[model samples]
Target: MSLRSTMHIPAVPAFLDSVRLRDIQLPLPAAPDPWHRLGKPQPCTASLKLSYSSAIAAAEKDDVSLSIDYGKLFRRLETDVREMAQHTSSPEHPHHRMVSVEGTRREEMKASAVGQDPRVTAGIVANCGLSLLDETAAGVRRMSHLRQSPRNSFSGSQAPPAPQPADAGPAPITAEYGRCEVWLQLPKALLRAEEGLKYRSVTVWGYNDEAGADALESESRSPVVLEEEFRIEGIRCYCILGVNSHERVEKQAVIISLGFEGPGQLAWGSTVVDTYVALTRAVAEKVDETTFQTVEALATFVARIVTVDFGNERVTVRVEKPSALPFVQRSGVEVTRTQAFFQSHEVAHSTLATRGEARSIEVLVGPASSLTLFRCPKQAALYPLEEPFIVQR
Candidate 1:
């Protein structure tokens, strides 16, 4: 698909169509206290795409049985993921809480202490004071500072990392807020010098079981599987975002995460710095202006802002409400949408009514400044975007 939304002629045949379901929410069990120790539990957003030419046969013959039924697949996944999330995130699920001082070491110490004379033991105990690290509360709040680098993020070491575990404290150690899984696949032929060729016949798509797994593990494709991605996290904003009576009147704090995929490169004439400034401002503006009844609604709305207004092929949005559940760190939903998605659906939003007469923000035609978004210095240049965005005061 084209990276930017424009009227275009598709070069590929119709039989090569793929069915994709993106950004399916799977709530995870709460993370461990000192949440990164054994495993971190956090809500996860996932995507799945199945590319096969069998769909063409079904379409050509109008036979429903020959092709995939996306609805059935979605419902099954939803049920399974929801059950897993509920089981894992439940407070009473079988999880070892903080280990108290009664392990084998304590038992050994007791045995050794039994043989010692009371006077000598008392004297030794008195001489050396027993300083307890256990008495101090766990600094759960400080975990926010631990994941400053991308390596610490839980989502991907290859693609852009997702948000790590964070909590304000007194919240269970199991609170996991942000993680994303995007398992995407394109043809292996994309790496060749002369690109944009379709080699596969629209009539077939599968392989022998062993050969298929082996082909996936090939050296050239193994590492590069992480798709070209652009992501921004921790966009803190306030809006009405729940079904509760009080939630309807009061604006609550929400952290939104936004990201999109490009076809290896960016749109023509676009720069990473300019895209970031423009998208960040646009997301903030849209988020602040729209009031959503649910986190999922908020996620979808933000996704439309990127895929429609911003003209990106695929975009994902995760919206978290910090105050929703006191026991969990943050609860939210994530969604991924494309330009084609908006084309097929009618999005009726009461929150996005037109404001007063609009005026266009002019592009910078003169000397650039430190705050300029028109161009980035040579060192930071990456990706292409359509037009220049004006970053005002």
Candidate 2:
């Protein structure tokens, strides 16, 4: 039976015709811990869906052009994800090299302005689990998983059912932020795999091939969401924040929890562009430099800093003041913002997008690392340094 003869089925939406790379499991970098031991490669799974309008016509003619070659796509995705997890994003303030325990301990003590500070010690200990990726055998297993699917490609399935033009509407280019457990439906299309193209097996959501149709049917029944979570916890800092004048006289303890929501290549062992440490330090420095009358204002400011500094799709900032009230257990504020929030606020726009030149002292660390010292936006005369800072746990 030819694919052209399979036209008894109803016309599907253009968005429904796409090449999907799902259930991709790869090894991640180990957590940032000097004391951490390198173990077996730990694999984490991620999914991707893509579409090209010209694929339908190309499949009909058995032409390679315009159709997505999923075998090639998957290979590229694996390499890109691995590279993304390996490199440190910041030019200065590279992460401490994972080496001897004694060297790590020495560095830890040196990092704290006051030798053996309890808070600093706690911060360093907490950062042990921060890496998102770990080197693992999961890559080998993933390759096998990709190959397990039967080779039911769109090439030469005896011609596609007539010719169907893509919809004139704008392409489905969207990025939504939410906590949902479901997979996005990739567009269904016929692709002409290159001759001798190894790993041609693709697990399509809906297709009746020698591959398990029952399993595919089960998957087609429930779609998946395209999003992941990035978290930073136990971020403790001292800031001049309080409602009362007495409280404003001295610095109080504040713990921050940051939850980043977005769609991107996130590995368990890779630093999300050193965001966890960078943003946490930025929040502390921002809070320390300025006095806040309310927790709401502090939370809002931190949220804005996170959105701008990291270029995250969405952020949720929770500022906890454990010793705010004598009798109360804790008092704090939680604020959430999307990219749209910064776009809407004029102050946020300037804070994130605007970078001005001002006189300040620059400090060189080691042979390569250097700090770009500058004045805070609100306090031009203060000369508060925003150097790359790290805190692991």
| lDDT values for all models | 0.39, 0.39
Off by over 4 Å in 2: 1-29, 34-227, 262-274, 347-393
Give stretches of model 1 more than 4 Å off: 1-226, 266-274, 349-393
Q: Estimate the Cα RMSD of every predicted model relative to the unseen true structure.
A: 29.2, 22.2
Cα lDDT tens digits, model 2, 1-393, are: 002111011123444345555676544332222122332223334454443232444455464433445676556545533443232232221122221111111233223222112112112211111110001112323543454434433554454344335663233211110011212111110011111001111111122223343443221121111233455654667766665534533567887777655432222112333344455556666665555657876777777777766666567888889997788887788889876787788874554333222122233322225433422223222222233531111
Q: Worst lDDT window (10 residues) for model 1? A: 128-137
Error of 2 at 262 (Å): 4.6
RMSD of 1: 29.2
In terms of TM-score, how similar is model 1 to the real structure? 0.33
Ten-residue stretch with the least lDDT total in model 2? 193-202
